[model samples]
Target: MSLALDIFTVVMVVAGLFFFYAGSIGMLRFPTVESRLHALTKADNLSVGFIALGVMPQMAEATDALKLLLAWALILFSSAAASQLIAIAARRNRRRDP
Candidate 1:
Protein backbone atom coordinates (compact mmCIF):
# COMPACT_ATOMS: atom_id res chain seq x y z
CA MET A 1 0.00 0.00 0.00
CA SER A 2 2.77 2.41 0.84
CA LEU A 3 4.62 1.50 -2.32
CA ALA A 4 1.55 2.18 -4.43
CA LEU A 5 1.08 5.58 -2.82
CA ASP A 6 4.73 6.44 -3.39
CA ILE A 7 4.41 5.59 -7.03
CA PHE A 8 1.28 7.70 -7.36
CA THR A 9 2.91 10.65 -5.71
CA VAL A 10 5.93 10.37 -7.96
CA VAL A 11 3.78 10.20 -11.04
CA MET A 12 1.78 13.28 -10.01
CA VAL A 13 4.94 15.26 -9.38
CA VAL A 14 6.40 14.26 -12.73
CA ALA A 15 3.19 15.19 -14.51
CA GLY A 16 3.14 18.54 -12.79
CA LEU A 17 6.72 19.18 -13.88
CA PHE A 18 5.84 18.29 -17.43
CA PHE A 19 2.96 20.78 -17.41
CA PHE A 20 5.22 23.53 -16.13
CA TYR A 21 7.74 22.78 -18.87
CA ALA A 22 5.04 22.79 -21.51
CA GLY A 23 3.74 26.14 -20.28
CA SER A 24 7.23 27.62 -20.58
CA ILE A 25 7.49 26.39 -24.16
CA GLY A 26 4.03 27.66 -24.95
CA MET A 27 4.93 31.15 -23.80
CA LEU A 28 7.84 31.19 -26.23
CA ARG A 29 5.92 29.67 -29.13
CA PHE A 30 2.59 31.43 -28.82
CA PRO A 31 1.95 34.36 -31.14
CA THR A 32 -0.13 36.56 -28.86
CA VAL A 33 0.09 37.77 -25.29
CA GLU A 34 -3.41 36.47 -24.62
CA SER A 35 -2.47 32.99 -25.78
CA ARG A 36 0.62 32.99 -23.63
CA LEU A 37 -1.39 34.15 -20.64
CA HIS A 38 -3.91 31.40 -21.23
CA ALA A 39 -1.23 28.74 -21.36
CA LEU A 40 0.60 30.09 -18.35
CA THR A 41 -2.48 30.41 -16.15
CA LYS A 42 -3.96 27.05 -17.11
CA ALA A 43 -0.71 25.21 -16.64
CA ASP A 44 0.08 27.09 -13.47
CA ASN A 45 -3.18 26.00 -11.84
CA LEU A 46 -2.84 22.39 -12.97
CA SER A 47 0.80 22.04 -11.98
CA VAL A 48 0.29 23.54 -8.55
CA GLY A 49 -2.75 21.40 -7.88
CA PHE A 50 -0.93 18.26 -8.99
CA ILE A 51 2.06 19.04 -6.81
CA ALA A 52 -0.18 19.71 -3.82
CA LEU A 53 -1.98 16.43 -4.39
CA GLY A 54 1.34 14.60 -4.53
CA VAL A 55 2.39 16.13 -1.26
CA MET A 56 -0.90 15.42 0.48
CA PRO A 57 -0.46 11.65 0.45
CA GLN A 58 3.14 11.88 1.56
CA MET A 59 2.37 14.08 4.54
CA ALA A 60 2.08 12.17 7.82
CA GLU A 61 -0.43 14.50 9.40
CA ALA A 62 -3.87 15.75 8.31
CA THR A 63 -2.97 19.33 9.17
CA ASP A 64 0.06 19.17 6.93
CA ALA A 65 -2.03 18.01 4.01
CA LEU A 66 -4.60 20.70 4.64
CA LYS A 67 -1.92 23.35 4.81
CA LEU A 68 -0.45 22.22 1.51
CA LEU A 69 -3.86 22.39 -0.15
CA LEU A 70 -4.56 25.81 1.32
CA ALA A 71 -1.28 27.12 -0.02
CA TRP A 72 -2.09 25.79 -3.44
CA ALA A 73 -5.52 27.42 -3.33
CA LEU A 74 -4.03 30.77 -2.44
CA ILE A 75 -1.53 30.56 -5.23
CA LEU A 76 -4.18 29.49 -7.71
CA PHE A 77 -6.42 32.40 -6.80
CA SER A 78 -3.62 34.95 -7.02
CA SER A 79 -2.42 33.61 -10.33
CA ALA A 80 -5.92 33.79 -11.77
CA ALA A 81 -6.40 37.34 -10.62
CA ALA A 82 -3.03 38.40 -11.97
CA SER A 83 -3.73 36.73 -15.27
CA GLN A 84 -6.98 38.65 -15.63
CA LEU A 85 -5.26 41.93 -14.93
CA ILE A 86 -2.52 41.16 -17.43
CA ALA A 87 -5.04 40.16 -20.06
CA ILE A 88 -6.95 43.39 -19.59
CA ALA A 89 -3.77 45.41 -19.94
CA ALA A 90 -2.78 43.53 -23.05
CA ARG A 91 -6.15 44.10 -24.61
CA ARG A 92 -6.03 47.78 -23.83
CA ASN A 93 -2.57 48.07 -25.37
CA ARG A 94 -3.68 46.32 -28.53
CA ARG A 95 -6.64 48.65 -28.85
CA ARG A 96 -4.41 51.70 -28.56
CA ASP A 97 -1.93 50.45 -31.13
CA PRO A 98 -4.45 50.41 -33.95
Candidate 2:
Protein backbone atom coordinates (compact mmCIF):
# COMPACT_ATOMS: atom_id res chain seq x y z
CA MET A 1 0.00 0.00 0.00
CA SER A 2 2.79 2.38 0.89
CA LEU A 3 4.53 1.60 -2.38
CA ALA A 4 1.37 2.38 -4.27
CA LEU A 5 1.04 5.61 -2.35
CA ASP A 6 4.61 6.49 -3.20
CA ILE A 7 3.94 5.88 -6.88
CA PHE A 8 0.84 8.03 -6.70
CA THR A 9 2.79 10.76 -5.04
CA VAL A 10 5.37 10.60 -7.78
CA VAL A 11 2.75 10.90 -10.45
CA MET A 12 1.09 13.84 -8.73
CA VAL A 13 4.40 15.61 -8.27
CA VAL A 14 5.21 15.14 -11.96
CA ALA A 15 1.82 16.48 -12.93
CA GLY A 16 2.36 19.49 -10.71
CA LEU A 17 5.74 20.09 -12.32
CA PHE A 18 4.16 20.10 -15.76
CA PHE A 19 1.65 22.70 -14.61
CA PHE A 20 4.43 24.79 -13.14
CA TYR A 21 6.17 24.74 -16.48
CA ALA A 22 2.97 25.63 -18.27
CA GLY A 23 2.44 28.59 -15.97
CA SER A 24 5.89 29.90 -16.79
CA ILE A 25 5.35 29.50 -20.52
CA GLY A 26 1.96 31.13 -20.25
CA MET A 27 3.30 34.20 -18.46
CA LEU A 28 5.87 34.62 -21.20
CA ARG A 29 3.60 33.96 -24.17
CA PHE A 30 0.31 35.51 -23.04
CA PRO A 31 -0.39 38.95 -24.53
CA THR A 32 -2.48 40.43 -21.71
CA VAL A 33 -1.88 41.02 -18.02
CA GLU A 34 -5.20 39.50 -17.00
CA SER A 35 -4.60 36.39 -19.03
CA ARG A 36 -1.14 36.03 -17.59
CA LEU A 37 -2.42 36.47 -14.05
CA HIS A 38 -5.10 33.91 -14.72
CA ALA A 39 -2.50 31.50 -15.93
CA LEU A 40 -0.14 32.27 -13.07
CA THR A 41 -2.61 32.01 -10.20
CA LYS A 42 -4.51 28.99 -11.42
CA ALA A 43 -1.49 26.93 -12.30
CA ASP A 44 0.56 27.99 -9.31
CA ASN A 45 -2.22 27.27 -6.85
CA LEU A 46 -2.72 23.82 -8.29
CA SER A 47 0.98 23.17 -8.33
CA VAL A 48 1.39 24.02 -4.68
CA GLY A 49 -1.65 22.02 -3.68
CA PHE A 50 -0.46 18.99 -5.59
CA ILE A 51 2.99 19.29 -4.10
CA ALA A 52 1.53 19.44 -0.61
CA LEU A 53 -0.61 16.42 -1.33
CA GLY A 54 2.43 14.56 -2.62
CA VAL A 55 4.27 15.30 0.58
CA MET A 56 1.35 14.53 2.86
CA PRO A 57 1.59 10.77 2.53
CA GLN A 58 5.25 10.84 3.43
CA MET A 59 4.80 12.82 6.61
CA ALA A 60 5.60 10.99 9.83
CA GLU A 61 2.69 12.44 11.75
CA ALA A 62 -0.89 13.45 11.07
CA THR A 63 -0.20 16.93 12.38
CA ASP A 64 2.47 17.37 9.74
CA ALA A 65 -0.03 16.58 7.03
CA LEU A 66 -2.53 18.97 8.53
CA LYS A 67 0.08 21.69 8.68
CA LEU A 68 0.94 21.15 5.04
CA LEU A 69 -2.68 21.39 4.04
CA LEU A 70 -3.17 24.54 6.06
CA ALA A 71 -0.19 26.10 4.36
CA TRP A 72 -1.60 25.27 0.93
CA ALA A 73 -4.97 26.70 1.91
CA LEU A 74 -3.40 29.93 3.06
CA ILE A 75 -1.44 30.26 -0.13
CA LEU A 76 -4.53 29.59 -2.18
CA PHE A 77 -6.48 32.29 -0.41
CA SER A 78 -3.72 34.88 -0.63
CA SER A 79 -3.09 34.19 -4.30
CA ALA A 80 -6.79 34.59 -5.06
CA ALA A 81 -6.86 37.96 -3.32
CA ALA A 82 -3.72 39.04 -5.08
CA SER A 83 -5.07 38.00 -8.47
CA GLN A 84 -8.22 39.98 -7.89
CA LEU A 85 -6.22 43.06 -7.00
CA ILE A 86 -4.02 42.69 -10.06
CA ALA A 87 -6.99 42.26 -12.36
CA ILE A 88 -8.69 45.33 -10.92
CA ALA A 89 -5.57 47.39 -11.39
CA ALA A 90 -5.17 46.17 -14.94
CA ARG A 91 -8.76 47.04 -15.72
CA ARG A 92 -8.32 50.49 -14.26
CA ASN A 93 -5.24 51.03 -16.42
CA ARG A 94 -7.14 49.92 -19.49
CA ARG A 95 -9.92 52.37 -18.72
CA ARG A 96 -7.46 55.23 -18.44
CA ASP A 97 -5.83 54.54 -21.80
CA PRO A 98 -7.17 56.23 -24.93
Candidate 3:
Protein backbone atom coordinates (compact mmCIF):
# COMPACT_ATOMS: atom_id res chain seq x y z
CA MET A 1 0.00 0.00 0.00
CA SER A 2 0.87 3.68 0.00
CA LEU A 3 2.02 3.54 3.60
CA ALA A 4 4.36 0.68 2.85
CA LEU A 5 5.72 2.54 -0.13
CA ASP A 6 6.36 5.59 2.03
CA ILE A 7 8.20 3.53 4.60
CA PHE A 8 10.32 1.95 1.92
CA THR A 9 11.19 5.32 0.49
CA VAL A 10 12.18 6.62 3.88
CA VAL A 11 14.37 3.62 4.50
CA MET A 12 16.02 3.95 1.15
CA VAL A 13 16.78 7.61 1.74
CA VAL A 14 18.28 6.80 5.11
CA ALA A 15 20.38 4.02 3.61
CA GLY A 16 21.57 6.36 0.91
CA LEU A 17 22.58 8.91 3.51
CA PHE A 18 24.48 6.24 5.40
CA PHE A 19 26.38 5.38 2.27
CA PHE A 20 27.17 9.03 1.65
CA TYR A 21 28.54 9.37 5.14
CA ALA A 22 30.59 6.24 4.77
CA GLY A 23 32.04 7.53 1.55
CA SER A 24 32.90 10.86 3.15
CA ILE A 25 34.73 9.11 5.92
CA GLY A 26 36.55 6.94 3.45
CA MET A 27 37.60 9.92 1.39
CA LEU A 28 38.93 11.70 4.45
CA ARG A 29 40.79 8.69 5.72
CA PHE A 30 42.14 7.59 2.38
CA PRO A 31 45.82 8.23 1.70
CA THR A 32 45.72 9.05 -2.02
CA VAL A 33 43.74 11.03 -4.57
CA GLU A 34 42.78 7.92 -6.47
CA SER A 35 41.54 6.30 -3.32
CA ARG A 36 39.55 9.39 -2.50
CA LEU A 37 38.05 9.38 -5.97
CA HIS A 38 37.03 5.80 -5.54
CA ALA A 39 35.29 6.72 -2.34
CA LEU A 40 33.64 9.74 -3.90
CA THR A 41 32.39 7.88 -6.93
CA LYS A 42 30.99 5.03 -4.90
CA ALA A 43 29.20 7.34 -2.51
CA ASP A 44 27.95 9.95 -4.92
CA ASN A 45 26.56 7.73 -7.63
CA LEU A 46 25.08 4.96 -5.56
CA SER A 47 23.60 7.09 -2.84
CA VAL A 48 21.92 9.42 -5.25
CA GLY A 49 20.72 6.51 -7.32
CA PHE A 50 19.28 4.71 -4.34
CA ILE A 51 17.51 7.83 -3.15
CA ALA A 52 16.11 8.56 -6.58
CA LEU A 53 14.86 5.04 -7.01
CA GLY A 54 13.22 5.20 -3.64
CA VAL A 55 11.30 8.32 -4.56
CA MET A 56 10.40 7.21 -8.06
CA PRO A 57 7.34 5.26 -7.04
CA GLN A 58 5.99 8.03 -4.89
CA MET A 59 5.73 10.52 -7.69
CA ALA A 60 2.28 12.13 -8.01
CA GLU A 61 1.73 11.79 -11.72
CA ALA A 62 3.20 10.56 -14.97
CA THR A 63 4.77 13.94 -15.63
CA ASP A 64 6.30 14.03 -12.19
CA ALA A 65 7.71 10.56 -12.67
CA LEU A 66 9.17 11.58 -15.98
CA LYS A 67 10.78 14.60 -14.41
CA LEU A 68 12.27 12.53 -11.63
CA LEU A 69 13.54 9.97 -14.10
CA LEU A 70 15.14 12.69 -16.18
CA ALA A 71 16.85 14.10 -13.14
CA TRP A 72 18.13 10.68 -12.16
CA ALA A 73 19.41 10.06 -15.65
CA LEU A 74 21.24 13.36 -15.68
CA ILE A 75 22.83 12.64 -12.34
CA LEU A 76 23.86 9.17 -13.42
CA PHE A 77 25.37 10.30 -16.70
CA SER A 78 27.16 13.33 -15.33
CA SER A 79 28.61 11.59 -12.29
CA ALA A 80 30.06 8.78 -14.40
CA ALA A 81 31.52 11.18 -16.95
CA ALA A 82 32.93 13.42 -14.27
CA SER A 83 34.47 10.50 -12.45
CA GLN A 84 36.11 9.32 -15.65
CA LEU A 85 37.48 12.81 -16.33
CA ILE A 86 38.83 13.03 -12.79
CA ALA A 87 40.53 9.68 -13.18
CA ILE A 88 42.10 10.74 -16.46
CA ALA A 89 43.38 13.98 -14.98
CA ALA A 90 44.77 12.22 -11.94
CA ARG A 91 46.53 9.69 -14.10
CA ARG A 92 47.94 12.40 -16.30
CA ASN A 93 49.29 14.24 -13.28
CA ARG A 94 50.91 11.13 -11.92
CA ARG A 95 52.47 10.44 -15.27
CA ARG A 96 53.90 13.95 -15.41
CA ASP A 97 55.29 13.79 -11.88
CA PRO A 98 57.33 10.60 -12.29
Q: Mind giving the per-residue lDDT tens digits that candidate 1 earns over 1-98?
A: 99999999999999999999989898889999989999998997899899899878999999999999999999999999999999999899989996
Q: What does candidate 2's lDDT look like per residue over 1-98, in tens digits?
A: 99999998998899889899999999999999999998999999999989899989999999999999999999999999999999998899899993
- Over 4 Å off in model 2, which ranges? none
Which is the leading candidate under lDDT?
Answer: 2
Model 1 lDDT, full chain set: 0.93
Output the worst ten-in-a-row residue range by lDDT, candidate 1.
47-56
Model 3 TM-score on a 0 to 1 scale: 0.86
Q: TM-scores of the models, in the given order?
A: 0.94, 0.93, 0.86
Better of 1 and 2 by lDDT: 2
The deviation in Å at residue 53 for candidate 3 is 1.4
Alpha-carbon RMSD to native, per candidate: 1.0, 1.0, 1.5
Instruction: Show the colliding residue pairs in model 3.
Output: none
